[model samples]
Target chain A: MQRRFGDQEVDICIVGAGAAGGVLARDLARAGLKVVVLEAGPFWDPQQDFASDELSMQKLGWQETVLVAGNNPLKMGHNNTGRGVGGGTVHFTGVFLRFHESDFRVYSQDGVADDWPISYADLAPYYDRIEREIAVSGPKHFPWGPFAGPYPYPEREPLSANAVVFRQGCEKLGIKSAVTPLAILSAPFDGRPPCINRGFCNQGCLPNAKFSTLIQHIPQAIAAGAEVLPDCTVTQVEVDEKSRRVTGVIFVHDGTEYRQPAKIVILANFVVQMPRLLLNSATPAFPDGLANSSGMVGKGIMPHSSYDVYAKFPEEIRLYKGTPVLATTQDFYETDHTRGFVRGYTLHAHGARPVAMATGISVGAGTWGPQLRRAMLDFNFYARITQVGEVLPSEKNTVTLADEKDDNGLPLPLVTFGYGDNDLKLIDHAVAKMKEILTAAGGKPEFVIPDTAHLMGGCRMGADPRTSVVDQWGRTHDHPNLYLAGAPIFVTGGGVNPTETVMALAARTADHLIQQARRGL
Target chain B: MATKSHYPHYNVLDAAEDWDPHTRKIVEARLLPLESVEHLTTAETKTLYSVVAALIDDDRSEILDYVVKHFDDTLGKRIGESQRKTGVPPQADLIRRTLSGLGKTARDNYGKPFPELTVDEQHTILGQLERGQIPADGIWMNLPQKEAFTKLLSLTVEAYYSHPKIWSEIGHGGPAYPRGYVRTGPGLVDPWEAQREE
Candidate 1:
């Protein structure tokens, strides 16, 4: 039976129990506030439910139908973003890197995209706190992004054969490479064992070594008096007609509708769902949608335009034995207009599993029958380098309500995206650079897989109410009590994974809420 | 009795046998026959088998039977139900129409059905279909022939590779569960993993 709450009232009601929601839940509940998190998916225990299957993990990703259209259309939903209590963190490869100082002032520095309302300095403390809280492991003194201190845990040792070969290429090409900062524990910390290098981090680590919010934050939050309601879909956010303040959220659990009243409502659902929820909550006073006074709620959706370059080697590499994405080089992370691109892309060695490799060889390698069979036999000799590049915000690349409705009778999200000229140039340069790196390591570049890694933007935060949805604190200008969390607040997506920054901003938002509550909010 | 030469180290349910109970269930669930095949007609299933056999260069009737059944079971109900902008037909209809087009191509080019064509002839017909070289007014026109071939080929390859016998031949590590990796440093191999004989 689905657990039902009788009170239907809490000091704070969070929409999604993802990276941001998990942090907010623990922090808010620990601050003595009655917090409740509504997760639209099941909560799986790591040790009990994790596995090493590609098919199962694909299902764990959001599979519900989403309409994607543009000059360069994207395959959304299933292939990207997880659908569970831990959200994307459940299936994340755990490459957590801090945003560069240039990431904060992209607009001011490059004359493109809007600069973040809050600086990196403002979010530095939270990043340090989250890294310490999660026991992040990395190289001790990496001259990459600015950080307050060294990694909380020691670095993961003995890089994968794929990374070793890729690093040889990096050295030959004069690119600085380092041990990727990872949430996967490198040593025993807080009773959790170190990573055994299971090679299935993308498939949900069974050993509980990978730091998913499901393993840490959710449990702490539950212990700190935060109620977690899984398998519950929030359909609409009801607001007071006269005051325009969010009254409560109407959700469906086990086919039964429940209205949970709250003093504050936080939408921490990943990029796509967050904007969909806001647009679905249109009221008479706010027809364009609640907290969408600027009409920027679902606009400017950006999932980093990414691609993968795979190379064939003469000898076996056994790229699948270690953590997926064991090493990453951000040498190309900073923009250089001389390189013929306005922004840059981060290139990393891909730790692809057997099933993923088989699929890639069959489709991407351009072989079939006896040749395909030979390629599959030679799978151990291939290595992949992935590019995660920034895409400047465009008014056209957006998330809107689809014509079709979901199982719950709510309209599905329709994402329309197209690569800009600058994006195309960056992708071309990144792919060429990756090929050069592979060539330097005595491997032949084989194929390219056009894909996106992280999703950001829609419901972006800014100081101007007329131009952006939420303020720097993630507080919506229309509803002072309503706040947004996670990648949706990013004014500009950095050339790195967005998970660490999402958690950091959540910490900052929680502090903001605590300060506001002290002022009788 | 001599040990089997082909699939010499085959375990019928390697993943299930190696994985913990929970992980085993997940792997087992996919292996079970999908209920979606009930939506396809017996003739449609037969056509799928023949087309898949031609595409993958598999002549064994049983392999063709298993491949088509697996594809139908997994994706029969959803085919042709939704159309992406890429022009790939709905899952069900794509299989139906593509097979229909292949049979027509076989008849038009060599005056024989696809299943009756020689292996080389079958490859010729498939190549034309894959390259979008088939006549414009026919079945392959409306469908994205290349994308359709890609989708079908991918599914066929997945089904073939997923079998226990193939796992042995390809030297896969099977499932990682209670026994996760330990010797995972650069070029390191665990004792249990498949070692390439010199």
Candidate 2:
């Protein structure tokens, strides 16, 4: 069940095993290159891991090791990321959508943002490759977005009855809706089972149907003879000023120190950790940080303009009986000036079971005992209306090294951000629409819980080396051989799941990384 | 009780459909429906018992009682009013048995947060429930307070997963838009990872 590598050096060093890091590690390793991935977490096995009991999940650090940093406070402020070998991709919702062509050029189009160095056309093929490699499910022909290749209809997990009804509501509004493109295995494909829709995905899939890098990419990396060190935490990327390069990475495992030297380094540690890691690795040449030439490694933070709406319907319907997340409405995916919000909002929809529903609506207190026992019966009749809006880029919304240190004596990353007035306006707008839909379905507000998902930013992408940490290829301006991957490089939070885009970008960089490695960069 | 209520899915469930607006695919353990849930899940169950034991060790009886009393919950006010109306509250022993099963964990039987944001918002939510703000698709439980433990628990362990972080000693994390960022603040060594060697 375990493999050993005493002192192995490699062609590439992948810092994290999340979406981008995992995929890149697998691809490069398959190319017969010696790859080493240092993950600062545990590796969960499907057979021996993934418990369904709620109590276990709570105690097991929610199956995530990306422990509490100073940045996110209040509520479930941080979307849980797997600290284990698979990383965030293990816990992702598998909703894969291409970045709208305009998404790459929001600044040019809307005069509100900076453009990604790569265009939609340039990254289109990588998207297709990832779609096929990961087995994405969706219509090949998307009428809304422009991209190459035919839609690979991978799998469609069972749609809950309520999801169908919600589709009707979207149609009634005449919004452009499509079968969500997802990484969830719809049928038995690539040695994985089909999704049976137990809707406990966030807890980790018992069935191999969900597309986690741990299942898909990491295994491939191993088969290609790559060294994946799970439970290994990379602390700093040691800089060599004489060579103007990253000579090695210093980390701790058990109680030992490890120095992983590599020709090429990829800072794929996600948006949050990317900046912190880089900032934590301060040197004489880069006293500010590793790639602090711009002082922008932790700037331009944007949490998905995340918000939610809930309506209590008149039915004992079980929402948690279906997929953890089914259909997401990206009807307003592209930015429209009319909406008052610069980046538009993507509507994510779902229902819940009695316990889950009670969790949401049970935010209030009532008489305990018999009085409480009769409280409205099973909270079966409710739906959760949620939206992910684009939070505008602001240097003020940044992730910095907090004064407090972790157990490792490293400064804990502090995420400082607040919803601005514009965000408030957008939430108000989103709430109105959500209310209308809920009321139309004959539901009324028991309450609304506003929260954000995919907490992004702290690291952003741009063309200006002085203003941005990474270029369009996700290469750090300061460290040419090093690349930054994950949602942190996201310049702006798109109105949809950023996983697909992250994969596409990683794939594109994988090709470039191969070229550079071949050239002996 | 139902008004111009359009459809249950859109209003309460936030239903999302990929192919059509009327159907959904619920993926499970790949077994045919009923047979699937029948399979004994040793992993989650074993882990659950351990967590329960730990919770009980923490001596948090209040939380256990809350989840037990509120389990199999019908969020509307019908259950409460019915219990009060029946006038015969259930025995204390039943509560003890149920609480013993849950072990100890914080239960937000009381309104948590947004309670302090505004009094009006708090009262409005409670008022709606008491004054029949119940949604149409909802099932009403008419149980005598103490005796009609029609269903003992409404939710599974997963239902309470979001509780400890939101309403307890643990806090939320990450940078971006954190709902509740844990400020282990400056100068304090994070005891959570204290075991991790430097």
Extract clashing residue pairs from model 1: B79-B90, B79-B91, B79-B92, B80-B90, B80-B91, B80-B92
* DockQ (Cα-based) for each candidate: 0.33, 0.03
What tens-digit string does per-residue lDDT give for candidate 2 at A63-132?
A: 2212222233312211534567777676666778788888878889888767877788888888878888
Off by over 4 Å in 1: A1-4, A361-371, B1-18, B25-37, B54-70, B76-113, B120-147, B185-187
The clash number for model 1 is: 6
> Could you list the iRMS of every candidate?
5.7, 19.3
- For all candidates in order, the CA lDDT equals 0.79, 0.57
lDDT tens digits, residue span A1-521, model 1: 34445556678999999899999999999998988899988898776666676655665677665666788766554445777888888888898889999999998889899899989899999988999999999988776778633799888887888888888999998888888889999989889888877678888878889998898999999999989999888999989877768877988988889888889999998888888999999977889888898999889988887688878887667666788787788888887979987768788898786567766666655566656666666666678898889988898988888777777888878788898888889999999999999999989987677777778999999999999999999999999778899999899888888999999999999999998888876
In terms of docking quality, model 2 is incorrect
lDDT of 1 at A301: 82
Cα lDDT over the full model 2: 0.57
